[model samples]
Target: MKWYALLVVLMVGLGLQAQEEKDIVVKRTLHLMGSTFEISVVAPTEEIGYINIDEAVSEIKRIEALISSWDENSETSKINRNAGIQPVKVSRELFLLIERSKKISEITDGAFDISYASMDNIWKYDGTMDKMPTASDVKASIEKIGHQKIILDPDEQTVFLQKEGMRIGFGAIGKGYAADMAKELLISKGVKGGIVNASGDLTTWGTRETGEKWMVGITNPVEKNKIYSWLPVVESSVATSGNYEKYIVFKGEKYSHIIDPRTGYPTKGVTSVSIFSKRAELCDALATAVFIMGRDSGIHLINQLDGVEVVLVDGDNKIHKSAGIVFDTNQYVEK
Candidate 1:
């Protein structure tokens, strides 16, 4: 799913009411990478806090310049412009990001693809679609979307798309990548604790200024305002992909905005999927993949990976968690 406008509510448990004498949490919220980002850091003084936050913002902007497809001069745009004609030499950072994206595509069997941009905008969730697209049109929309067609030359630091119109985008993973980069930059600047919340794709390191582990509340997809559970995010990342805010109903059948790249159709059954992992980038990509993978197969895949867990809410409003995730919530349901 292109989560730029997806409604994801991650209730951060920052103790704003009380604080310790020596340390305090400073935060800033702004728009970046076409999404909302909240950057927070532990600092002894407000002056130092804003300075650190500014540094993180600069780092995020730097990443935006490199990865944004909207920017015609970006490496990603350059590669897209050269599709099928020639390989475009890119920086090692972009090359590696694409390489990692392809690896994720392989893992999910194309449930998540950076090449999803090649798809024609046939389905709109903004209540403008009077009817569904024809089957042939839907099928043709995804003809150019295949990560396998993306060629990467490590030694030459280049990327090439085999089809002339083929395109790749980081909409599903860009914010998380930016968050990860911002966190790393903050840590390198001697910040003891912080959080980079790229909308709902968030990562936390160290603890709150109160010296307590960072806690995050998982919002109930059905209830919207209600939180089902709160869990400690100790040095980890969380990403939630939900269809509650953006979806369409046709012929009494609801369709999520998160489409299956393999079929070029909206996913069904699952309403939300939240992933917990060591990196926000992985959590961000896997959340969308798991939502499209559906409940059974998604849970199965998460169980096999060490240090990765899932908490998914189905269309029935029932919550399911992987083996490693233990939380007390009335929404829990077996199977």
Candidate 2:
């Protein structure tokens, strides 16, 4: 009788441990820079332990305060305000982010430019009907959109935009950077095996409780909830950029919200681009750059880089993928 009771207790304990290994989801919403950001983290309930969600939220807000351009007192805003004159010293963190952004600019040959904010908000895509801007207007906008004008002083940890009206915003890279930082923070706090999902930009570490990989659904551009393909992701970051979010129709032509800095016009040929990389920051910036570069150049760029893969959907819904991506064709409806 004593032996049977001990065996029963051991079995119950094992069952509880197994149950705890199931995936746990924690989410929070915070208002930052006039936008509501929804952050979700998924991890095993077991392992080392769980991180304090409140602490994670506070850390995210701290990063937001440092990087948000809408804040007049932010490091980036100060540098923008002092453009064309002297370099304004900034925090080491901001300086490193700027340096990384500049490297991406070089890699994409200005296709992923940070100076794009210099362009005037001439193209309105919010359901307004109007003819396309004139040639002169386009030319004027392109004149101020050169990444070459940005100067960095490593000694002073400063950034200087050569044009007075020039500005640098991290609309493309901020969320991914935030996700990376949050993941690092969580890991440092001894929380292992988790995912930090910032909207569509997602980064995951470790396998699920069943020892299987985390499954990520790549959304179809035409259909919001419908996933065109499901990819197994682990210890990788995925980011997607599509023109379907915001666009304008002018003279029977549709233009995307993502404008090419070089020509000051919407990029053509590609409709959506999804990038898989080890770093969330690179994945984030490259997704935008690849979308702007179109299918051919985008493929060339991803192929040249090691450990980076791409899945591109053209305007006509044709899907193109890099050699590195592995998945089942039957799971997706081929276009």
Q: Which structure among the candidates has the greatest lDDT? A: 1
Lowest summed-lDDT stretch of 10 residues in model 1?
Answer: 1-10
The alpha-carbon lDDT assigned to residue 52 of candidate 1 equals: 97
Q: At residue 193, give the lDDT of candidate 1.
A: 93
The CA lDDT of each predicted structure is: 0.87, 0.72
In candidate 1, stretches whose alpha carbon ends up further than 4 angstroms from where it belongs are 1-14, 17-21, 221-224, 330-335
Q: How does residue 11 of candidate 2 score in lDDT?
A: 7
Clashing pairs in 2: none
The lDDT, on a scale of 0 to 1, for candidate 2 is 0.72
TM-score of each: 0.94, 0.86
lDDT of 1 at 154: 92
The best candidate in terms of TM-score: 1
